[model samples]
Target: MIATNGDLERGAVDDQVVVRGAVGDDLAGILSVGHRTWLATYEPIAGPEYVAMGLAKWWTSDVVTDAIRKGRTLVAVLGDEVVGVATFGPQDDAVVLWKLYVLPGHHGLGIGSRLMDEVVVQARESGHDRITLSYLEGNEQAARFYARHGFTETHRETPGSGLPESVWMARELGEREQS
Candidate 1:
């Protein structure tokens, strides 16, 4: 097997819901939460097979570490347990939100929006003109969520090779969301 290029030791996680330093440790749990969140968010659009395969590759400890080290990743916690994870990173001159996930039970509680709010605030503070993210086009709920948060469909992207394709969304950070 080829060795992963992820630098597992280069990340430091902070607690978003309470204390700080909630990045590593018990990676299995974090991955489990990631899997659950993926299922909840992607199952309706990408199907279970895609979600499963993606989880297998994306939820690994190494991948998570690489993301935290390279991106702005925030972990949501209630006490000592992490219930969610969100990441923002530079992608092609825009700040892309790579991950914004919460456990199934944590949904509908504004947790996802809270995470997005934090990301938007940070991106704006960092002088990002816009933020972008992609989601399977078939996922209407997710599309609605992004729309509610002021993201507009900017383009469509296809990975080909049976990979799930998605719509790219962009929101201008300098503009305020209209009420």
Candidate 2:
């Protein structure tokens, strides 16, 4: 938890917010946030049918537990309440951004960016040179977000859930911005 700071709502910060390493107990909250945010953000682009099934298939405590426990799971909290989360680990030869999501009400407040920035830092520290993630092709919102954050389209894919037209994105992590 990073103490709401100016990230969540601005001006009205939640003093108790925390950005911490998630353990098993936090799996449910992370999954809940993922489900809520995905539905809120992707439903418009993914459509009701695909988003609905994606939610049902992906938003499970077990799935989340498996994600977090596999490598590194980080959680964002607003005063004991979860607002966002991300998980990262090696995907074959590259570091993978397993998931990066922010709750609906907290969107556009830089929460997602912050989580991603931290992941990039960790990946760099770990000596990873590349990172990969994917989003629905129709979900231009997410594609733009990732592009703006330094990712580029590398390939198209069929989503694991059988959803059509996913754009696989990647970023070279070794490129460092001048500080």
Candidate 3:
């Protein structure tokens, strides 16, 4: 039920982006944004084969549907279009950010930052001391973005997918007012 709106004056002038919790009806939009962003962001870094493998393994509608059912999904809407998504939930006693993607065309308009802000808000509200996430090793953009938001690399691993090494990162959370 969490929802908020912000104005993005760049790119699409006067664009108002809304961030809100995902519901059952938002499955299609979530899947669409996730698929498009994944292809656009990872294809260049990992090549077609690796992107396909990872998509098949993780981006299926069923997987997203299940996450929504568990109340662990959020969507950023620009007008009537779903432009960004983030999914997070508890894992091993820490909140794990499973996914965060903003449409390539919507990049740099603060949509991703808005989604991330919501993630931190939720983590703190849920009494989590830390948040964790992993990105492909070569995704320098992701690394820099997370680092700017206080996440620091904790370790690295090569998942069975064999695409590339994964860099795990984490950030400690403190009580703060939601923005």
- Per-model root-mean-square deviation over C-alphas: 9.5, 3.8, 4.6
Error of 1 at 95 (Å): 0.4
TM-score of each: 0.78, 0.81, 0.87
Per-residue alpha-carbon lDDT of candidate 2 for residues 1-179, written as tens digits (9 for 90 to 100): 44443454553443344677788888778878878887786777666887687777877777777876765888877776778898888877688887888887776666677677778887888888888998877766677789888898898866555455878888897665321
The local lDDT score (0 to 100) that residue 104 gets in candidate 1 is 71
Better of 1 and 3 by lDDT: 3
| CA error at residue 90 for candidate 2, angstroms | 1.0
Residues 73-177 of candidate 3: C-alpha lDDT, one tens digit per residue: 999887677888999999876899999998777677778888899988888788888999999988888888888888889999876755778899988886342
- lDDT of candidate 1 over 45-68, digit per residue (tens): 667888888888888888887766
TM-score of 1: 0.78
- When 2 and 3 are scored with TM-score, the better candidate is 3
